[model samples]
Target: MLASVHSEILREKLLLPGETLVVGVSGGNDSSALLHILVALNKNYHYGWKLHAVHLNHCFRGEEARQDAAYAQELCGKLGVTFHLFEFDVPAYMEQTGMGGQEASREIRYGFYRQVAKEQGATKLVLAHHADDQVETILFRFVRGTRMQGLSGMPKRRWLEEGSIELVRPLLHVTRKELESYCEENGLHPREDSSNRSRKYKRNLLRLEVMPLLAEVNERYREHILEAAEAIHQDHAFLERLAIEQLEKVLIVRKPDEIVIDNEPFQNCDVALQRRMITLILDYVSKQTEWSSQHVEAVLHMSGGSRPSAELHLPGQLVVSRVYGRIHFCPKGREERIHMYCYELPVPGKVWIAESEVWVHTNYLERLTDWERLPENEAVFDADRLPGPLFLRNRRPGDRLALFGSGSEKKLKELLIDTKIPRAWRDRLPLLIAGDEVVLVPGVRRSAAAPVDERTKRFLHVRVEFGEDWREVFS
Candidate 1:
């Protein structure tokens, strides 16, 4: 049993030599067997791991919870491992957070694990989520309207914190029956949670009732489920890579609060890639937005509609808008202009200024237009001379502008004052940003940064319109 368990721990460098680890010991069959196996490996294999056993008393089972924590500490002591125990009121936490009892308990338990690992300077938080847990999770999620991601089940190893801390399940391939046998042979009398016996819990019902029924139907149901889940996980990972590659092809520009993509390139992608890209975009521009398949379908329908312009508001203040062939996304209240914001202005494309209710679009001109008769809402520049990857943003402090045909630069504040632009509207006005220079301040001033000259081969024509008419942006 020890040899079999050792093979799985070394499956993917789950446990390293001379490293600190925090083991979650619930004094249950699975966790107790996990601790025993790890301790045996550490001693026999000369893997100098500094083990710290952590037990969290969730206060759900009252006296039983106390015994669970005590047993965990005793077991750790017998193995010569440092023990740490923490308590949290799972019932009270559920009340304050409005979470279900089981969900709240797991949340508190995992949080306690993270805290202990951090305190102990551990790199990995080890848990005993065995193969049975994976089979049950996959089966549970399948019955609970979960999609592709859910059917894959829990990962053997995943980062608890992106780079700093990882959570590993060394016994992910181990079965509950195998663990129980291991515990008995090792003389570690692990406790069983009384609550697990209650059929009121959906998981317990599935385990006690549904699982047995499935096993009677086919004794190898657990093995079959595990195989299917592993295949789905691999397929999901492949799809993710394909989606990321497709996303880069269509994405025109991205900012801290906004993302702009070309519909032409986006529509060319496979439906699978398209759906994934939308989900990824929504994920990037959200603050814990709980989006679902319904939201993704709505965005698809909105973008594919007959109208040239449309908009939808999703959870987390995310605003999705379609302007002809361009799709835009930013948070709500971004149009208020109180925050410092920047927008990308793609060459031969358009930018909608939500703050000023203005649309600024660009096009490449074959010849220079008459500047004397040009409207204040339009400007022309040498596309060959201007820098690539243009942007439209508000004025910044200490910004200097080099006027057309002028050798010197002028302070933006002084320029705004000279133009009689109101103080309140100074920060609200959109300025065309090219690389590091302020190229154009809409309806106010134009800079000499990319002036069209006699040697100019391509002309960049920029036109601005005032209003929320996205159709005008497309035109």
Candidate 2:
């Protein structure tokens, strides 16, 4: 097994002469085999690769985790390799991020690995993902309605942290049984993680229960799955290149917080390319490559819609909007607040607020309607007394508003709380601003300073709507 892995690494040119490499050792059979084999290759073949071992104690399983770290440290010590160890509160991370145990552990583990690689100045980080793991990953994604990208499973080599470090999995071609045999044959007693046998986790359940039953049907299931993944990965890579090319042609604007594309060209492309383009944009914007099929389908449907202006809210506070002839993808709150910008409202026209996903319309009225019967979302102002070029924006600090019929002015924050608005929505709520004063808060209040009177000659009618149905708010 070691000879096979060493030959594969050489053929793949995974390691360079005298280059520093960080090996992630979890004290499990796979990592233990990886560390031992690499150490042996260095001694015999003069591989000349500087090896450093890193172990993350995922503050779970209490004493058992500590023991695993200690064992990894001891093994690295015996091999004359520098050992690095760190501890992280993974349970706390899971709770904070609302991620499951497996996801949280993997995220924390790789983050620590990246830090160690940077500190050690190692260009490559080694992982111990094997053939069985690949099979499990493909099967898991298959059961979850994956596309070709997900079907590709894990790549053997990829760049981490924006090419700052390389992650290599040399064990992808090797099986778990072979790794266990290699460890036993070399007298390397790897520490066993008891949690692997637990069925609470999806991966564990698949490994312990589902995979064995599948193996009964065909013992070569792992190899077949690996082959399928390889084929899918090749096709995915080619499509990704084409998608990127298509994106370059249609993408009109690309910024850190937002991306805009010409909808006509994108809509005319092949559906496959469209999906890839959407995924690429999403991954670039979110800084992750884990979008679902449903998300892509939703964007596709929105892109194909005939509405002059439409918006779809996605997970992670992302909003995809189609306006005029362009499609805009932006985070709901590009920063802490929904982009503190004042957009000039067009008179007798409609303006779409990307941050709030609300449409604001202004109309010139010859006569005022009954004030008591008007919807709360609609506000009438005396056009002759109002300032020019009214704008819509979020509330700024120290912003005060005088409600109609109220004697005193109050801060916007105080008004929001009194209205029982959610604290999270306070900063993102839309406010109609004229010059420096907040005139109206949609579905909330109309300022006393801008009320229409009996003597008014012209009236400015403003209304706000949200979502596909343009649900009207009556305050």
Which model scores highest in lDDT? 2
Global local distance difference test of model 2 = 0.83
Cα shift from native, residue 219, model 1 (Å): 0.7
Instruction: Tell me the tens digit of each residue's lDDT in model 2 across 1-475.
Output: 7679888899998877787899999999999999998888888888688898989988889999999999999999999999989999999988897776776787777887888888888999989999888899889888876789889998888877666788889888998989999998999999999999888878799899999999899988888888888999999999999999999999777876678788899989999999999988987776543677888899999999986667898865688877656777888854254557668899989998887778899998988669646776788998777755589888888999877786789889988767655443566677888878888988788887656878888788999876532221121
Off by over 4 Å in 2: 255-258, 308-325, 329-332, 335-475
lDDT at 219 for candidate 1? 96
Worst 10 residues of 1 by lDDT: 466-475
lDDT on C-alpha atoms for all candidate structures: 0.81, 0.83
- Candidate 1, residue 152: Cα displacement in angstroms equals 2.4
> Could you tell me the lDDT of residue 73 within candidate 1?
89
